[model samples]
Target: MSQYGKLMLDRYPEKMILPESSVIMASDGTVLRRIPLPETGYRIKAGLGEMPQLLIDTFIAVEDRRFYSHKGLDYQGIARALVNNTVRMGVSEGGSSITQQLARGLYLNRGQNLLRKLNEASIALTLEKQLSKDEILQLYLNQIYMGQGQYGVKSAAERYFGITDMKHLEIGQIATLAAIPKGPSIYNPVDNLELSAGRRDLVLRIMQQHKLITTEQMRAAMKGPYIPPVKDKTEIVGASYMDAAIKEAMRQTGLSRKELCAGGYTLVTGMNIEAQRAMERAFSQEEAFPPDGKNQRAEAAMVIMDQRNGEVAALLGGRNPSTGGLNRAVTPSRQPGSALKPIIDYGPALESGKYTPDSLLPDIKTTYGSYSPANLNGVYRGQVSMRVALQQSINAPAVWLLKQVGVSYARGFAVRLGMELAAEDNHLAIALGGLHSGVSPLMMAQAYTVFANGGILNKAYLVRSIRNSQNQVVYSHVAAPQQAISVRTAADMTAMLRQAVSEGTGRRARMDVTVAGKTGTTQLDLPGVPGKANRDLWFVGYTPRWTAAVWMGFDHSDPDNYMTAGSGFAAAMFSKVLSML
Candidate 1:
């Protein structure tokens, strides 16, 4: 028996079970929201000493009359239940003691079979040898399921009766709570009040018969007024931000969603509520976007991050956002157009020690194999400096420079800046963002951090720290900055991008603070289409303090559903969001 007890104790989990919810908080310690476990609703723990005397006595009388006297199982109670159930011709009574019930709940599933019953009895004996009677009772009261998705007595009391303190509960309310664990669904107070009240009266009679309560006390308790459950009114603000934070936390801690939901953790995130609300408001205004036809609306996503430490301040997955929906801010579906020019073309060329901002390159129409690249306007300068070529976002010179730098070397440089490229992305079309799979707005923002942070890439993250239920720090963020390019390369790229924003194609994104950015537009090719219709528009920009990437397009690109205003509209939206910050 002793050896079996030791083996069971060794196999027990360090932390027995996960709690109800994980609290997500902002950096300033303001609670953003509580993410509840899907299986169990909400649980607030109450120790055995905190329970009222009437509640305890009633539970003991109704659940297990020999609870204190029995070691783990009550033979007399089991014999009586077997005889009664045999007489009734069905299994209607449970002969398990309180300790046995606790063991079953903690270790075994609710399967009605002889093998499971034997296993439950063995575990019950092991628990009795290891734990005191008070310890077993406390665990049972805190883990037993009540009705309405509540787990423990404290959660049930506060949820059903709005009583936070268990001692403040009325006699009838206490009896009602104690009667729920038998069959929570059948006797749920909120769903079936009369049935729950009848169960409460049965508990009162049992307490009286056990001499735990007087007849007058039981009668008065049964005659009390019935109270209904109050509705929970906690509003979930910033669904998109919450969704991103949950994903990031899971990635950082290597825990699954179910584990995080039940771990009772405090996830401190870098979300700025004011900035999140401002971005949501900006996306809410329809006039800020291009005039898509009445039947279809253009979709957009934006991500903002602190360039200093890579903390994601605010994010918008889409115009009409829903949690766990297609998060376009992090989903890479559309091409980036000329946004790849700065990172893959100019930055890598300058980092090679063979090119500078003033290095001359050809901008005329050219072809390598069957692929020929052209400027957006079908006009180009013969030989322009690299700065001039980047400011105007000339496509011919970018492809020429990528050819000169060697596609393999240039792509290697891009990979270090956080762009996920495939083997098929190995041609001159990469200079024009014609990859098999394009990059997301999150990848764009993180890649630009190299230039903003002077050649060091700060990986973007949402969660700053995570604390377990015992208030111990389980995980914290540490800076892991990698040098992706030379300091001179970052400086020259920033200077050229600033010119692009101030005087060239990105002028719509210019603001009071010194801004550096690039504009990109991918044109749609429809057979016999007269004019250039854009399928995607992108603007990736950064101030000294913040970096943001914005993308505007349709969810599905067709001849009828495309952008009419080009990347300037995306740049203008970036400016609008920047002003609010």
Candidate 2:
């Protein structure tokens, strides 16, 4: 029994999760996104419908030559495998017939022993009787484990070529797939090109030996560049960001890992690839903001939203997605400092019908109960309009506006705008971005969508559609934009934002297009530094075409590393990326 178990274990093929059902393409079939499968084990039934004759023939020729004659185990092949593996010392050693391979794959463990081998034969024989020949072949195709956490031919195809249909396989492609079952690592095309080519030629030679292909076809298959499509190259840019997104996706989709992997769910996401690449380009420029030696690091996070779609176009959770994996974008709930003023004070003021783009407010030094808010200059500007107050990010004027708008009413308005304002009833200090738990840039982007889309808010999505291994539609995503504000009111606020960008505190953000945005800075409220500028800076803005938010701060508080609010380093990074975009 022990010896049999050992043999079964030695021959058992590794099992892995079935391929996930996901189709990442635009509504027009232009692929834009792809979700990978989870790591698990599953029976192969994904690609039985469209598998080509050549694929089946190749599997038979390489896996089990006497498949028709054998009951369940090919004794001759087993004898040959035992002799070759024991005597011939090359890495391409051992041969298990298709039935024996299937036996080990399905019923036995991966240990080498006679008892397990005998058990595998028994199960193989049983499987042959219980399942049809075609069904057995299908099961074998799906059950066999390919290296790299892949199982089944369908998954292997998609994992490697980013496609599903088996009929698509060329002769060279068939040879490559054929080569994997024999010592997957030795013939791993990604790792060793020469070994992979040699194995492929060997498979082609085997095909010719079995008369499965013409001599000319065999010759052509061996000549060169058996290059299959690139597969399994997951571009993990901010491993932290991807992890965060996956967690959120899983939570929102409500799909189990198996369902996510095999159900072919198309997750429509709000991520914008162009904006993401732009952010990557900005941060990856080492010469712009090099670290202070090794200890002092430079990192950044930015979020771009489409005002019309309310979809998150791009999000950079960290300065370097590869090494620095912390997702600063979606995870961090950093205080917006003066950035919160617009949501609490300005947005509410606009909604109340008591304020206009030209509404006047005071930026003078003033105390509201226990709290006193000051401007970045720490001085007083006697009288300023609401537009000037917002542009300068004056603390006192925002507080006064918050008070005039009624704290409770303002808080309610902020919620309507999507700011998740922590204040139960808006405190005057809420205008200064004072809250217990702050908001993420993602949420902030969602809030700003009100001003961009003439008041309609669309849910964000990253995936477009999902299809099963058989190319059957499993899930589809359709965007539904909701009305959050009136077009007139949103346009009125946009006019003020335009001034904030063109002639006010956000003048540094001046660009070619009609750019409108806000700047925010927070004082480091630490001992002996009540008014010291924090390392944090922000410039969240939008144009008719795009809306984006950029934030910059030190990993640690270094006063010298700090920028002057919207005019700081973060603003520069935002500008650099926006220019490229």
Candidate 3:
């Protein structure tokens, strides 16, 4: 490697190349998401060609009038600055060329020490020989930090003027941003407008004198109607989805975190903006969940999937989709509550061919070692059909049925449905939604699709494809469908779930269109909490068009005031999202 290459890596390690955001777009080409770059700096990558002539000229005129004429250092400018500083007894101006400035920003510390200054100069000279003037300028434009957590010309333009293309910027706006690098704290147009305007006029004056802008253009720009941007807070879109997609992409592509961020990849996802917006509106409602306060807060998550293709239509990880926090839809394995019964116990029971929907099952309570269970309403009929037993979600009957069919069979079935069941998961309590680890909303939703899609099981996926800067496809999705169960079994299970929704605990999820689903509410014993309350609530359901699962609960451990009602929380939210479709 050359000296400049070594210097670039030694100072600004390849890892410090600065992260560029990957865009997430919907299937129909609608741009759905961009994760908010951290407060460290927000830089949307762009080439030198993206810079406008006016903005580029303004920068050169104000910062270095002899920029194009200089090789890497301007001896005359340095002499003048030295003379001026000696007379003033202070450093008022910098003599570094644009290439020198880029070197400092990229590979040197922000200090005025002589040793650092000499190093900066050495590196700048080396860089000029190694790269073109335009390349150095592009790096400078991207690495320079503007005020308010923005880096790069493209991001700054978008933040300050709502303009993605720099060429679209007005003359006054161009001058305003050009003046910011002098002292962003003082000349930031967003916070201190009056000071910024004065600096902008000074830059315009220089442009006029340098003949970079016409005298008439300078006068109009100085008169100034610079409309600053209105977005004070960065509005991130589909952050949760993007967050998961990046992780998945990294695993599949075997790219490091820095490489993935710096690759400038474009991710196309199965997100439907309409469905996502509807889910967002549902959570944003005035009464979606209990109010949050202090260290304690109620949280909920939902995942809507296209059953036929296993494409994730919409996913809300938590209340704040922009946070990119723990994605409950894909992580945070919580007990599926009664939602597990249909797939784990009942669905497999019918698929085994030994049991039919009309077959009689014992609903009477019986002891299973030290564990005994009761129905939700505390009333159990002596004998009931399998359909009625499932509809009522009778706990005793489910437990007995698991024993009759053998616990291994039900647990194995859940594993085949894409759930990673363990030895601890193979117990009679598994029939009553008891498990080793909880299920994610994504897994639960996909499992239920076996019935909705007529036994075809498609792997739930968010990203459909990824492309690089050359518009060449780097990654594409291949459809993999498995026949998880018999068509006869899927049809029978679908009928039973529909009956449950129409007449049982899932009645709260009634929709105008035909729907099949199960509501699950699990009450676990708390150490010191009172009232024998349930902690987790879940609603896993599917329509012919979409399969969805909803989970509502407190993020913290169950306290004395744990809320555990699935019908009102999960079921209602499910209805809100599904009804819109």
TM-score of each model, in listed order: 0.78, 0.83, 0.89
Higher lDDT: candidate 2 or 3?
3
Can you write out model 1's per-residue Cα lDDT over 13-121, one digit (the tens) per residue? 6525636578899877777866656764877676777889878877888888889998988999889988998899876676989877887787778876666667777
Candidate 1 runs further than 4 Å off: 1-20, 30-40, 43-66, 73-97, 103-130, 154-251, 254-257, 290-297, 320-323, 352-361, 383-385, 469-471, 528-531
C-alpha displacement of 270 in model 1, angstroms?
2.6
Those runs of model 3 whose alpha carbons end farther than 4 Å from true positions after fitting are 1-18, 24-39, 229-239, 256-263, 284-298, 319-324, 367-380, 468-472, 526-532, 556-559, 564-568
Question: Where's the lowest-lDDT run of ten residues in candidate 2?
Answer: 12-21
Clashing pairs in model 1, backbone N/Cα/C closer than 3 A: none
Candidate 3 lDDT, tens digit per residue, 1-581?
24654566566655345566656688888766554454445678788787888787778887777877887788888899789888988766568888778878777777876666677777777777777888777787887877877777788888888898788888888888899988877887887889999999999889888888899999998997668666535234566777787888888788875566555678888988788878888888858775443455678889999999899988889887564478888884788878888887788788788999998998887998988877867787899999998898888888888888887787777766777676767667888887777788898998998889998889888889988755798888889999988899899999999998899878878799888999888775777755446677889998879999998876765463576444457887889888987
Mark the 10 consecutive residues where model 1 has the least summed lDDT: 1-10
lDDT of 2 by residue, 241-346 (tens): 3444455555656766556645555444445555666778777787545344234565567887767766566777776664235677875466677766667788
The all-Cα superposition gives candidate 3 an RMSD in Å to the true structure of 3.4
Alpha-carbon lDDT, every model: 0.85, 0.67, 0.80
Deviation from native of the Cα of residue 402 in model 1, angstroms: 2.9
TM-score between model 3 and native: 0.89
Candidate numbers sorted by lDDT from highest down: 1, 3, 2
| Weakest 10 consecutive residues of candidate 3 by summed lDDT | 32-41
